[model samples]
Target: MAKKQHYKHNNGAMYLMLSPYLLLLFFFGILPAIMGVLEIPKPSMANANGGWDAFKIVIHDFRFGPALRHVLGFMGIFVPLMIFFVIGMALMLDIKHSPWKKWLRMAYIVPASISGAVAVLVWYVILQPTLSPIKGVLRYFHITESSQIWQQQNLVYILAIMAFFAAAGNWILIQYGSLQSISTEVLEAARVDGASVWQTAIRIKLPLISKYIVYMSVLVFAGGLQIFVEPQLLNGGIYQGIADSWSFDQLSYNLAFMQGDFGGASALSILLLIPSLLGALLVIFKTDMFEGAQGHIKKKDVEIVGI
Candidate 1:
């Protein structure tokens, strides 16, 4: 009777604790998701036509192909490079007792606190060709005389660097946390067997932390797909290199405000939500990410008869 009462009390406490999150999920997450899929009636079409023409038009738009390609290209370059550099930096800093670890970690995390816009502005100053500090060095070696790093062709590289600078530090912190969670006894055992640091890292540590790396990679990839402000701000808005509807988000913004096409904008917004939704699903279900592998293990006793 006491155990039954205890269980009931625990169940009530759990429900009480979960109520706030349930409320938020229903109102914010589930509601918005449902509304996003529903067809919105447009003022312009209320009388002219009552059909799915707006969504069909957005689906067949020429800008859709180029915008998707551009965003995917950015993701291709940004996600892998970000993961490699961030994980490498995290591993280097994970030698917690090393003398320079504190300062090195500090340097990596400092940029994460700065806004993306601010970082882009800083990069613009540094990559401004003639006035840029590196440009002077490049000029000494007879590099180009032009003062623009914001060239049409170089936009991919420029955006990649900007993303790396803005995002790598936060990923490093996540990787570092994962590394810290690893048992010290495992490292000690590898050391006892006279395994070199490189060998241990490759054969043991990396496998252990592989899921964390994949988790961060998918997260960064999703973020890269949603990139907007850096390219827009760097291009000075609606410029030649970056079309008005270069990215999906940019397309939605332009449709809503610039072109005054609310229905089209809403359609674009629903389209843009696809990649993020797929990424989130992949993170949650496709990978053993949120629940670490340690949770799945069970201890069992085996008895041996005297032989």
Candidate 2:
């Protein structure tokens, strides 16, 4: 009984130690969510029955459709491309026999330290027609004029590349660490069983790191849905006919600040948060990411005795 009481006391102390983080989470995450709900029109407001009118206005707006389409389209392209690059780079860097592993990792890690906005801006300059490294090639191909690459119809592709550049390095490092955490004994046993490099990576390593892939995918998708800065900076904000370039978050921002439609903005914000919240919930429920702080199989304790 005394030991159990002591354990309960220790748990209480640990939670007390975590009070700061809990407070931050409450203030920034929970408080804002409550505020967003409160910002909705009351039953006596112009809506007369509550926020449904705001929801209707936001949902029916022409901007909402295009904003949603752009976010979905960007995610459709960006998520897969980013995942492909992240996994590919991680695998290349994890090559057990590779001489340039350290160099490749350093190169990949460099971009992750750059802010997302700054990375996009750098690409903006690099892909500019006259000043770009590929200026001569673009000119030769007649793809260069006074205009920049983001000004073209292929802005979607340009955005994908920029998003990948900004985000994939962090994911690569994550996947690489997960891959490194893989038991070498399992890998050696596969090699002994005549597993080629491709076979090992595809059949063994990939499955082992599936959890990390799923975690990164959910996070990337969530973040991609709320995309704002790249499109805002790229298109110079709120184009009339080209609303597809503006994201939902940008639309919400414009509604709140640019037009002072607080109710409408709140509706849009709640809508935008739905998928993000779902993704976060899925991560929390589906992964061991939050539990016990020990999820990955340790290489040291792994044995190859059976095979």
Candidate 3:
């Protein structure tokens, strides 16, 4: 009877400690989710002329498909490109023979500390038509001053570059840390087996850090879907279409404020919420992210390439 009372007392204390967190989760997470579901138009209201008709109207909009396509294309380009760079840089920095690993790592991560908006503006100045550092090269190529890269067909490339500057450093930091976490014995075994640096990195180190790669991919995909700041800040009113329906988030914003379609904006927002939520769930349940930092690839689990 005394032990049972003691257990009840401990349980009460635990609940008391968890109360604040539970309250915050309810207010910020659960409450907002409930509100979002309420905002989505039901089938009856979706067929109406105005209130919840946003679901029907937005789906039929000409710009809807293009907006999704642009974001998907950007994700397709950005995730793979960033992954390659991140892994390459991480491998370079993680090299046991490197003399300047610390300084190089610092240099690589510095861009991540810069604000996204500021990074976009800095790229804007460099890519601007007349003020660009490469203006002379433009003239050498016989390109007229009336046209610029930002305003030309190469706008997609320019957009990708700006997004890279804003996001690449953070990913490098993640990849580099993952590489560092790898046990030295595994790397030594690979080296003993006559594996070159590239082979060891590609085969052993990459597999060990596979979970990080998966997490980063999901994160980059979700982030890519929500892209608005880079295109909006980079264009700076020089081009109109870059932000009008360039991304779904921007499209939802335009619907809400520019067109006074609150219901439609809410509907679009709810639709976007699905992917982000799914990605979060994947990281939480599918990956070992929350498994107390044990990491996915153990030293014993890796197969030597040359042996």
* Model 1 per-residue lDDT tens digits across residues 121-182: 77766665656768867667565644344566666777778788888887888898888888
Model 2 misplaced regions, further than 4 Å: 1-18, 42-50, 146-148, 237-245, 291-307
* Model 3: worst 10 consecutive residues (lDDT sum): 298-307
**lDDT of candidate 2 vs native?**
0.75
User: Model 3 residue 17 lDDT?
Assistant: 100
- TM, every model: 0.78, 0.82, 0.82
* Candidate 1 colliding pairs: none
- Give the range of the ten consecutive residues with the poorest summed lDDT in model 2: 298-307
Candidate 1 segments exceeding 4 Å error: 1-24, 40-56, 140-148, 237-243, 292-307
Task: For residue 199, give model 2's deviation from the true position in Å.
Answer: 1.3
Give the best candidate by lDDT: 2
lDDT digits (tens) for residues 1-307 of candidate 3: 9999999999999999999999999999899877766665633333355555666678887879987777777777787888888778778777675666667767767777655677666666676557767878767876555444556346556666767767788788788888888898998899999999889988999999988988988887788778887766645455655456777877887776877666677788888988887787667656786678447544343232211
In candidate 3, which residue pairs get closer than 3 Å at backbone N, Cα or C atoms, i.e. clash?
none
Candidate 1: deviation at residue 182, Å?
1.7
Query: lDDT: which is higher, 1 or 3?
Result: 3
Of candidates 3 and 2, the better by lDDT: 2
Write down the TM-score for model 2. Answer: 0.82
TM-score-better candidate, 1 vs 3 = 3
Reference-based lDDT, residue 239, model 3: 64
